[model samples]
Target: MRGLSLKMLKKITNPVLLRSDLLMVVLNRDSHWILVVLDLKAKQICIFDSIKNPAHKDVVFKLVEVLYQESESFQSFAISEWPVIYVELLPRQSSSSDCGVFVMKYMERLLDISDGEWSWRQYLNWQVEMNVFRAQIAYDIIKFGEQFAKEPAKDTKFCNI
Candidate 1:
């Protein structure tokens, strides 16, 4: 099932009715989550086009990084679009339970963030390795609550964030 085109994947958001041996992975896109289906028997990956609740991006990003980092063939997965996600069969000999383990890792990471370290380390090292950028944090914080001005005075391009 390799060499599948990006075009073919775009139409696969169906409820994944075929297999009980499936592994579902939901990763974030700044705000919403995309569900990825792994067909354990076929060794193929299917990403669903779905959007979900907005929560903490940092924690979600961390989860994705750790999962990809540990997967042996992870580097070969294709992700061209800004919010594209990767899915693949749970390696043939492995148990589908590992998928739950992978998701739990993210939940643990989120709990850690809420502990209030009060120290913000540049997420750069992990970000660089995982290829994700947190460039919007400073802006997101600074402009988080102001009302959108309907009409800014001429000659001024107002940026909310």
Candidate 2:
């Protein structure tokens, strides 16, 4: 996973330095998804895993090192030394297949939160609501695809069909 992350970093055309107050990364390890958020303003990394594993902290530390080396914006601050917070109190998934959904919901909730204040209690019952969330996601994707398909082709001369 570490090697894959470094390769991904090398392939990025746009560096993530100072682009936003928060940087969100979804990492897949052994079929499980984990959400990692780099809070630039707070100088810390927050890990949101449905399973709540302590090992993720070490993995994030290595990734942060690569990020620090690759970007000039991190040169002034010790980003690698930033605190790695494992958000254990957030919602947990009872089933293994829901990790990806949990990660997506985590991102959505994070974006919806105002003033950096996170309320984990609101998502405590997410396990029961997984099916509803899954349906909503699928509906949104199909709706987006339908909307995109409605747009006229830019080069209509290429193919009539």
Task: Choose the strongest candidate by lDDT.
Answer: 2
lDDT of 1 by residue, 1-161 (tens): 11232222332333432333445556545444444544443545445322222333344354335434443333333212124233232111132223333343333333455653423233212322221213344355456544235443565422221
- The residue pairs in collision within model 1 are none
Look at candidate 1 and tell me the lDDT of residue 14. 30
Q: Which stretches of candidate 2 lie over 4 Å from their true place?
A: 1-16, 151-161
Alpha carbon lDDT at 53, candidate 2: 82
TM-score of candidate 1 versus the correct structure, residues matched by position: 0.24
lDDT of 2 by residue, 1-161 (tens): 45655555554333545467788988877788999998878988999999888887776776677777875556555677888899878999988799999999999999998877888897797999999999999999998899879985577642331
C-alpha lDDT (0 to 100) for residue 108 of candidate 2 = 93
Q: What C-alpha lDDT values do all the predictions have? A: 0.36, 0.80
Best-performing candidate as measured by TM-score: 2
What lDDT score is found at residue 101 in candidate 2? 93
